[model samples]
Target chain A: GAGVSQSPSNKVTEKGKDVELRCDPISGHTALYWYRQSLGQGLEFLIYFQGNSAPDKSGLPSDRFSAERTGGSVSTLTIQRTQQEDSAVYLCASSSDYLSTDTQYFGPGTRLTVL
Target chain B: AQTVTQSQPEMSVQEAETVTLSCTYDTSENNYYLFWYKQPPSRQMILVIRQEAYKQQNATENRFSVNFQKAAKSFSLKISDSQLGDTAMYFCASSSGTYKYIFGTGTRLKVLA
Candidate 1:
């Protein structure tokens, strides 16, 4: 079975620019999540989408971070006015359901380097 | 808020040897889930094993097993007959009755040949 996949495994952008990172979840997966890994900040949950709607957006670090899932299959996380601190690995994961105990399968992650 | 902790920052083991990575968590919820994920140089997080808080017996998959102590809030991963492929950054995580998961800082394991 094909696992979750993310686009642009590595992205290098200038500060103040906006970048869109895409995530394609596995077939029939209703639960999708976005997480960030930084050198200073181990790993932090950015957002979670159950189907096409997001229920918990508190994990987002700032207002500049936003994400959307369309048709409950593909999701895009957008970051505006990128800062140096925003340089990190963006990871996407998906599960079969919205169950809390469901195991999540992760993508290779997009490494964003803000230059 | 729940917090997961992986005390060991790095660990090394010889091939075909056995190694244990320690993990502890703090949470108020009685029912939760514990997981150990291995991320190799490829950068994909792979699920090694999982343990349910309600289950007294630990979870195991092949040569990978977990020592889960609910009372002490401890969950550790043991990899037996370690191979070179076992080298990776291992993370311990928990979801305390929530849709969100809390992950640790990760332990970089090096399986030396």
Candidate 2:
């Protein structure tokens, strides 16, 4: 089975430009997660989706960050007016369900570099 | 608020030796799960091991095992007969009733050949 996939493995954009990162979770996975890994820092939780609804969005660094999961399969994280501080590796993970015991499978991640 | 902490930022261990990475967390929820994830240079997070809070028995997977102290709020990962392939950044995470996980800063482990 395919693990998890993220598109545009690397993206470089102007500071004010908007960028959208896409994630394709494993088939039949109902739970998805988004995280940001800043340089030399740990993974920071962004948002989580159980089915198509996001139950937790408190991890979003700012209002410029938004994410949505559609069809309960794929998710898109959009950053509006990106700042240099937003430059980091964005990772997506998925699990069979939201159960605490379920293992989360992770994607290779999309490295976003804001100039 | 729930928080996870990895006191060691970096560490090195000789091949075939044993090393333990320390992790501590603070959570209000009594029922939860603890996890250890390994991220190599490839930037992919891999599940190393996991422990259930309700179970006092430690979890073990091949060369990896965990020392879970429920009362002390400590969860440490022990790796025996370390290999170069084991060199990576290890993250400790905890999740309570919610699905969201609180992750630690991570520990960079280097397995010397």
Candidate 3:
């Protein structure tokens, strides 16, 4: 792909339902990142994936939040039993490599709304 | 833990004027990077500029330049000859050699016609 791509640009779900957000990073990029942005807030670090090694899941907020990157290309962010407070825009970004000082390119972001 | 702060929530400037957005960050690591990103209403996060912690010279890209004071932990964005297209939410972020970027709350800039 020319740039990072996120699926379901907008999602509205019930509070108790689970939702999945997807990200397709640029082809050949080795590092991917996920971030959440609440209303009028800055981007919050969520998770990071670098070339198939163990992901940096320290920022997942809770055990209910989990993410995985398949084949080091596409990724998915799953939220279990979504809560109203979970409503926010989920962003995905990718860099050519973790070691490169190059800036990370961002996707359009998925706006998740939990009712 | 690293933290980024943007003091101004909202700012307005006339077209062709100049405006500066303030940002300060706290980090323990000596090797790190600072960045400024812009998000328009369309929801696209665009990279505006970046500064390396070891570099004393600030980073600049056309009308956008940064004043990075490592000693003070201050990084500010100065928009010269501001245009209506420049009106957007600007964010300041920091990353310690680790890839995770810590972002500030963001400052909304409006260029009045």
- Fnat of each prediction, in sequence: 0.73, 0.80, 0.62
lDDT of 3 by residue, B44-113 (tens): 8999999999999999999999999999999999999999999899999988867888899999999999
Would candidate 1 be rated incorrect, acceptable, medium or high by CAPRI criteria?
medium
Clashing pairs in 3: none
**Each prediction's TM-score versus the true structure:** 0.97, 0.97, 0.96
User: Residue-wise lDDT of candidate 1 within A7-34, one digit each (tens)?
Assistant: 9999999999999999999899999999
**What lDDT does model 2 reach?**
0.94
True lDDT of residue B1, candidate 2: 90
TM-score of chain B of 3: 0.99
Candidate 1, residue A73: the lDDT equals 84
Each candidate's B-chain TM-score, in sequence, is 0.98, 0.99, 0.99
Per-residue lDDT of model 2, residues B7-108, tens digit only:
999999999999999999999998999999999999999999999999999999999999999999999999999999999999999999878878999999
- Using TM-score, give the best candidate's number: 1
Off by over 4 Å in 1: none
Q: What are the per-model DockQ values?
A: 0.75, 0.78, 0.66
What residue pairs clash in candidate 1, if any at all?
none
